[model samples]
Target: MSGLIGKKIGMTSLYNADGQALACTVIEAGPCVVTHVKTQDTDGYQAVQLGYGEKKEKRTTKPLLGHFKKAGTTPKRKLVEFKTFERELSLGETLQAADVFVEGDFIDVVGTVKGRGFQGVVKRHGFGGVGGQTHGQHNRARHPGSIGACSFPSRVFKGIRMAGRMGGNRVKVQNLRVLKVLSEQNLIVVSGSVPGAKNSFLILDK
Candidate 1:
């Protein structure tokens, strides 16, 4: 359950042995600072809190400023707690992306899907609207036809798929293979597409 907090940089393509192009996501993984350490005896749990990205002092609260100062680091933009690590980590210690992941590793990426605001049924639920415009169906093409029964359980049923809000939800894309780990650049290239737009925070878990 060890991982790092990363920022989705963008996507790129790579050619394999057969010269086939493969799409990959590029993430700026951490050179995160170990902000806090929790032990069973102290907090009734075990977790290592790491901080990533840089934020200004003016933007940070007084309490958070003190917390970062105690860790011997500057203000950070993100804080995440991991349950365990391959190696013991001390408070105030720094961890690079290469230290936690390697090439060929399969990792799960957690992120918020891009916000789509309000959407209709066709776009939201893959609904097959009234197929043809026959039978006086002039303006009913993309409608979610017939929501209720006549006098039988009268109300529209709960859990019936209807269009409302879409996206902007937490999602986990699992078992994406790690294609490359550029330690010098603090970047990790992973196979396939990742959720959310560029610069969104992602939790990469192993």
Candidate 2:
């Protein structure tokens, strides 16, 4: 398959063959169940829907419950559609980490980053504050200075990097090398860190 839904297990240090320790992120990849398959004739495009993470039946809605029932699987918390696959997949078929990735493969990861609420320009846009602490700039140390033009434009421009909310964005980190794949555990170790908090869902793309 071109991609799989996974959870960020966390970061750890792994030693390579050259005896160098490398920082890696461990992801609990599928065991994703195929929930739906769309073909060219039926949907105008080819795509396969995969579901991950278990959900209690009582928490599921009527429409979603019926959808899972059609696939012959229990309720799933997250459902994602992938447009590419290595082979044809039937409904309710399971895919693990071994199926989509292997060691030495380069892939991209998509996830939501941890949120930092109500930040300033210093933290959000890397602006080096307003003035030095040596002066009487107490609150101005973290302030965003000079946001508008002097009388000519007369208004603040759009897309200025003044901070309000920060992070919690859907970010894609690309070209992470796959370090290890544990099929039995449905886990894959990848070089470098991926975005998001622990247990947050991530899309691993080839």
Strongest candidate by TM-score: 1
Q: Could you give candidate 1's per-residue lDDT for residues 1-206 as a string of tens digits?
A: 89999999999999999999999999999989999999999999999999999999999999999999999999999999999998899989988899999999999999999999988899999999977989888999898888889888879889988879999999999999999999999999999999999999999998
Alpha-carbon shift of residue 36 in model 2 (angstroms): 0.4
**Where in model 1 is the C-alpha error above 4 Å?**
none
- Reference-based TM-score of each model: 0.97, 0.96
On the 0 to 100 scale, the lDDT of residue 143 in model 2 is 86
